[model samples]
Target: MNVVHILAALSEPTRLTAIHIIWDGGEHCVCELMERLNATQSRMSRHMGVLKAAGLVVDRRDAQWVRYRRNPDLPQSAACIVDAVIAATDVAGEVAA
Candidate 1:
């Protein structure tokens, strides 16, 4: 994955949080994310699109809903960047708390 593209996609807070939620190891549907993130359907879809374009996530069509999960094919280097970003965010959140 292109580091610049990935970083750019992750620049938004919603996209970053979406990545963290997807990384928690399950296929999350758009409706689920909308409720959890307090975002509208369009907003969640837009964020998911960014993550998809960045190659950070993969989606599956489940009936009327789209479910998202971490991209299993992501390279180790790119995955490391994702991990670091998530960890950094977690630390930052704790400090803010």
Candidate 2:
């Protein structure tokens, strides 16, 4: 986990927006992300790709619905920082399995 890379990704405005949405909304599907960000699937996918690569998020597929949520098992200072922000503002209260 490159801490610099993770910070770089989250520091982007669009990705920060996505993170706030996901952090508040709990797990979200691709459609939810699109609607929330007012972004195309390709755009959202690109942002999600960055987050995933940063080890800051995780996705679980239930049927055809892929739910994206904050990653709890990532070993990085960046993950800790993101988790702190999320926890401080975590309206989700609890992360779903």
Candidate 3:
């Protein structure tokens, strides 16, 4: 994945948080994300779409809902950037709390 695309995808607060949540090493359904992020189904789906397009995440169809997880095929360099972004935001979140 292109570094610029990954960074751009994470630029939005909602999308950033979505990635943070999804990065927990488990697939996340859109409904779960919607509740956690206090977002509408449509809103969450749209944000996930952006992440998907950026190759930051991959999705699977699960009946009525779409589930997402960090792209396992992400290049090592791209993974490093994602790690940094998550770490930075994780710290920021802790401080804010």
Candidate 4:
């Protein structure tokens, strides 16, 4: 995936938060994401679409729930970029709180 596309997908706060959650290394249900981010189902789904299009994440249908996680096959460079963004966001979050 193009770095520009990935960066663009993560450029928004809601999307970034979603990425951060997924980066923690487990599949999360869409409903769980909505609760964590305080977002509606539609809003979470929209952000997830952006991330999916960027090839940073993948989803699977688990019965009634859709689960999402970081794409394990992501290129090394892309993974590094994601890690960097997460790190930066964590530091920024610490400062804000």
Candidate 5:
């Protein structure tokens, strides 16, 4: 995966949170993400498109719903970066709260 592309895709807070939720919870439905992230369907889909384009996540149609999960074949370095970002953001969130 192109690090620059992946980094750019993850630069947004909503996108970053979506990744973290998928990373921590495994596959999740679009509706669930919408509720948890307080985003509209179209907004979540747009962000998910960015993640999919970055090779960081994948999705499949589950009847009427779309489920998303982290790409299992993600490069080690990219995975490390994602983990680091999640860790840093989680800490920052905790501190801010």
Candidate 6:
């Protein structure tokens, strides 16, 4: 994973919100994300694209739905960046729980 690129992706507020939704809920479909984030598909997908490009998110095909999950094997910098984001939001406990 390109750590720099991943960190860049995560540097945006809306994308960070997307990460929080994905990381907190574990694997989730696009629709699930839409509901949780109250975002349009186009907007949600835009954020997902950034995460995918960063190699911080992975996808699975299940029927017509595409599910997304965190890529735990991400580069060190990406992991650290995510860790800090979660810590700042007090969302890391949701991850552990």
Candidate number of the best lDDT: 4
On TM-score, the candidate that comes out on top is 1
Report the Cα lDDT for candidate 1.
Answer: 0.88
Q: For model 2, how does the per-residue alpha-carbon lDDT over 45-67 read when each residue is reduced to its tens digit?
A: 89899998888889898786567
User: lDDT tens digits, residues 1-97, model 4?
Assistant: 7999988988888888888889989999999999988899988899999999999999999998789999999999999999998887763463245
What would the per-residue lDDT of candidate 6 be over residues 1-97, giving only the tens digit for each residue?
Answer: 6767867887766677678777763898988888866778898888899899888898898997788998867767767778786667644444234
Please give the lDDT score at residue 68 for candidate 4: 100
Residues 1-97 of candidate 3 have per-residue lDDT tens digits of: 6789899988888888899888887999999999888899999999999999998899999999999998999888988898899887763464245
Model 1: lDDT of residue 12: 78
Model 1 lDDT per residue over 36-74, tens place? 778999999999999999999999999989999999999
> What lDDT does model 6 reach?
0.77
Q: For model 5, how does the per-residue alpha-carbon lDDT over 23-70 read when each residue is reduced to its tens digit?
A: 974889999989988899999999999999999999999998899998
TM-score attained by model 1: 0.90
Each model's number of backbone clashes?
0, 0, 0, 0, 0, 0
lDDT of 2 at 65: 58
Task: Return the lDDT, model 4, position 85.
Answer: 84
Tell me the deviation in Å of residue 30 in model 4: 0.3
The pairs that clash in candidate 3 are none
Candidate 4 — which residues are off by over 4 angstroms? 90-97
User: What RMSD does each model have against the real structure?
Assistant: 2.5, 6.7, 2.4, 2.4, 2.5, 5.1
